[model samples]
Target: MVQIKSSKYLDFLSQFGVGGAHPGGLSLTMEVLKNESIDETSHVLDVGCGTGQTAAYLTSRYDAKVTGIDIHPIMVEKAKKRMKKDQLPVEILQSSIENVPLQDAQFDLVLSESVLSFANASVALKEIYRLLKSGGRFIAIEMTINRPLDKTEETDLQQFYEFQSLLTEKDWIHLFEQTGFQHIHIHPQPSQQQDNAVLEDYHFSESIEPETFEVMEQHFEKVLKYQGILDYRIFTCTKG
Candidate 1:
């Protein structure tokens, strides 16, 4: 009779070491980065970087100086292991994105993948802005509802994922504007492709609780029930 609720779902994902847990997965990530002006000299920070999938790709693909941070201990450990195994010099840190100990204006780019909704978006945005150099860009592929949800709908979904708030596209824009971000853009989401088994990105933990098995069922049910209402968007902006 065990079950997972709230942020326990995050623990489930972490224990299973799910990679590309973000919406649209790694294929979309590759497509999105193609538009960015990244190179070997650029310094990049991947906030809430789960298991370092994107971080590894950033290093191998663009050869950018990449650093990854996540609040989950298991995730941080896995990310570090990935770096060590691949011999990639990507620095991985275990820290909350809301108040990282990094200096101001230190990164050329900051990336958040399906992470901010689970955090205090306002606080995290400010910290991300502080970490970016002048004219530096910030991009996030995060949850974005198309419209507001009623109390029941809101409670059910928010409780499942432990989202601080379910933000609409407009709500997200307001947060960005209030955070003093400039040239904010909501990019079109790519069509979700099927998971490629050959490139499967799961690194299961040595042990998993029986309660965690119910999480995937409940998650699928919610996604089906909400459908279009639970969609996500790609948000891009710059710090002045």
Candidate 2:
């Protein structure tokens, strides 16, 4: 069996079996938003919108008009279903971060949480720059390595590393600057408290195939190592 990577992993994560947005890993994603101010009426683009949690939060908390895009079709479908269920007007699309299909300068707030690492970081940042109007804000909850890694460690974390094209914090900062962002800031956010109940519920869900369950079990161990390499950060950048 092929090991899950990129869009396939996202599709796996979107299912109820995985407890999509319940892991509270996105606490950092939420923290980044709390530190910034955005116009309620601004058109927002949520790149790599995993299951619509952040998009819904933006609409409910900031009243922003949200267009959420993800490479995973399953995620887009679930997000759309979630929005419809809540009577919220957010639009969800199945798309890629490397090649966003939206028109240029169409968004005022561009936000990505743990998403850009899944693509070419520089290219995604540049695409984000192109989409946002001047003076727009870009916020992300991302993994940033503290130092360069040895080849052994890199090989050990191949699946985790390949699933995300992670960069050191310095590299990410340089990319942000090069992409024409200003007033960049990065804040560390630790993982949320693990709820055994949530984990139990997730374990009991029917959508998880036996093979996927085994992969996720292995994946979690790798995630811990990856997070250790990169201090988890809530990075915010402003479009110039």
Candidate 3:
């Protein structure tokens, strides 16, 4: 088994139990899911599922059999609780994406939102490819760096997000291809206008751990400073 380093940043998100931490939030997830062919027969996996929001949506909306996996135990617990409360049948597991504790070729769709950049992208992508059945789809929304990051900016981002690797749009496509994924599609989300109102809306959870809060503060600062360089992308691929 591969050893996966625990991320304090991820721990923060799990502790706060944020429902829509991804770029476009749950609303965007709904829009993307709308285009996919999902139903009672589809077996879906939500990689790095946080608080079970997307998993619950998949079950309630499409009635698909959904399984969620996250690296944090607290996240798994919270997700399971959310599913139980909503009376949705979702199996939530606490495990790293690089080494998911599940059988191969079991899922028709694998969904990841703002997840891959934080892990060893190559390893995670390979695992995702292995988990999908032939012709299965992989859809992900992830943070990307459109331009080259200076040494200082790169160091700050790594420190703030504990990201294993930050890739450009091209880099992402290369990795997907190297992992034997085909029919790749990349869509970049429109950049949000950086305004005072948006910055003001940024708030840290009071319940977050003190250490996590400090990191969050640093992350917020960097995001504000380098807003133009940071990008969010949606990728869809198929395993042949």
Candidate 2 to truth, TM:
0.84
Q: Give the distance in Å from residue 215's predicted Cα in candidate 2 to where it truly belongs.
A: 1.4
Colliding pairs, model 2? none
Order by TM-score, highest first: 1, 3, 2
Which regions of candidate 3 fall more than 4 Å away from where they truly are? 1-4, 188-207
**Model 2 C-alpha lDDT per residue in residues 1-240, reported as the tens digit of each score:** 212245435545665523224334445455556766766778999887877877877898889899998876667777787789889999988777888778999888888777777788888898999999988888876766778878887666555446456578888888888888999986654555544453232213346566655566666777676676755466788887
Q: How would you encode candidate 3's per-residue C-alpha lDDT over 31-123 as one tens digit per residue?
A: 788879999999999999978788888999999999999886777778888888789999998888988989999999999999988899999
C-alpha-based local distance difference test score of model 2: 0.71
Please name the candidate that would achieve the greatest TM-score relative to the true structure: 1
lDDT of 3 at 106: 99
Let me know the TM-score candidate 1 reaches against the reference structure: 0.94
Per-residue lDDT for 160 in model 2? 43
Q: Name the candidate, 1 or 2, with the larger TM-score value.
A: 1
Ten contiguous residues minimizing lDDT sum, candidate 1: 1-10
Candidate 3 lDDT score relative to the true structure = 0.84
Query: Quick one: ranking by lDDT, best first?
Result: 1, 3, 2
RMSD of each: 3.6, 4.1, 3.7
